[model samples]
Target: MTTYKESGVDIAAGEEAVKKIKNDVKKTFNKNVLLDIGGFGGAFNFPVNEYKKPILVSSVDGVGTKLKIAFLSNVHDTIGQCLVNHCTNDILVLGAKPLFFLDYFATDQLKTDVFQSVVKGLTKACIENDCALIGGETAEMPGFYKKDEYDISGTVVGVLDKKNLLSNRQVQKGDILIGLESTGLHTNGYSLARNVLLNKFKIDDYIEDLGCTVAESLLAIHKSYLQPLLPIINNENLHALSHVTGGGIIANTLRVIDKKNEIFIDWDSWERPPIFKLIQDIGNVPEYDMRESMNLGIGMIMIVDSNNLSFFENHLNSVNQSYKIIGNIK
Candidate 1:
């Protein structure tokens, strides 16, 4: 008779991993989370009476190839934050506030400490955004994943009043495009980035241009615009929002605009961040590829009525948020 452990599934280790992370995960709960970890299902109370017409907006996303940087750098913590924040921004573009989040973590071997660190990152972001980490699944499969490597994906659920739902219909001609600066290459373009950078430089190599090591630049946490944009999200002058992710600035911004209207982006509006320039010069990457793949410095785009330009600019300035008038809807 073959034991489960003999088959490479250590039930005891799995139990131990859950025990370590139990308390950390609980920190993200508010009054709404009904059940805790290790349950058949996590239950969250929906505050139905909070809105006149509540709309449930949900998005599921993974960290993508950016995880490769985490694996190479031996940093497991920030990757979880990347997944949570990425999902938060996805629903945020629709003008929703996160209610709860669920994560899926899978690995070939169970490393209790690494697992705990990842959950800590998740709980940190969830707490920051007032989102609950209701539940998640952790799997240990011996032959499935590569050695000492894991993958994570998360699903975020948020709510918005129907009246606050932002759509392309709200975007109009003469709408000004305001771009929020990105921290770095936030959770996208790693396939090309790694190919170019890693070939010529070690992960820890310091470059004067970047002012940091390759690991530092590549593993920068993805920014969550929730707190910064929440104040003006419902304003009448704020027409639409685009979260720059897998698609670069142009494609992602175009996603939230009307098909009948086209966006004019001044490519020279903002200087490309150093990490991007390094990738281009070393690899001799074409400008079109750079524009198509990376955020190229701008992370979030807001299309606001030109008449209210001063209002939007003032609000952002008051909050100490930097922005650029990259273009307008034509």
Candidate 2:
């Protein structure tokens, strides 16, 4: 008999993976999650009376070609964290706190160790963000995917008070831009990074400038700004927040400005992280292309009232979060 297992889609292995990941996922659940992992659909109970007016905020993102680095390095865990954190920040721009998350994981065949490692990453980030891992889908397709190749994507649902919504309307000329330092590349620019460095250097090759191997520097987790900003999101000093991702400083930061207002970045305001400089030096990448493609140094940027820059700076300093006034809205 030509069975599914014979065809290489191991149902038994898939079940085993679910069994292994169930407990770790449950650890991330809150009182709001109404369904568990094996359901036809994930159910989350909205906290109705919690807000004067509740707005549901949602975002879905994958780690992009950055996964190639994870695959090459055999580091699967951080990839999940990158997906969850990326989704969290997308909704956070609208002043939302993540509620619950759903993930999609697929590969040609299941590797339980890799599967569990990725789940651990998702669970860690979900717990840190105070969101539930309500449900996720894992598929083992025989012909669709090749070798050990796999993909992961996540959907994050967050909620916020409508009265506290943030957008371009809040941004005005003369608002200062404060940039939060990134761990490294985060989840974007790996395509270019891999092209420039992968063939020329081994993943373990050491570079003096980066102080780490190519893999270590590239696998840095995309950060979540939820914790620091949540406490001060509604402060009058704040105008809008930008999560710097696929588009670097210029494109992503410009999203919150009115057409009449323009972005004026003091490129020299903060030192570019060494990995970026290496990428440029090796690839001979143009300055503008580098800015448009990579985070450079800043992972997140906040446009705030110029009058309250010192107050906000004091607040951030109290938390010991490294940030710089990189620009102004002109």
Q: Best candidate, lDDT-wise?
A: 1
Question: Candidate 1: TM-score?
Answer: 0.98
Query: Candidate 1 at 99: error in angstroms?
Result: 0.1
Residue 186 in model 2: lDDT? 91
Flag regions of model 1 displaced more than 4 Å: none
RMSD (Å) of each candidate, 1 decimal: 1.0, 1.1
User: For each candidate, what TM-score against the reference?
Assistant: 0.98, 0.98
What's the lDDT for all of these models?
Answer: 0.91, 0.89
How far out, in Å, is residue 255 in model 2? 1.3
The local lDDT score (0 to 100) that residue 297 gets in candidate 2 is: 85
TM-score of 2: 0.98
Residue 218 shift from truth in candidate 1, angstroms: 0.4
lDDT of 1 at 142: 92
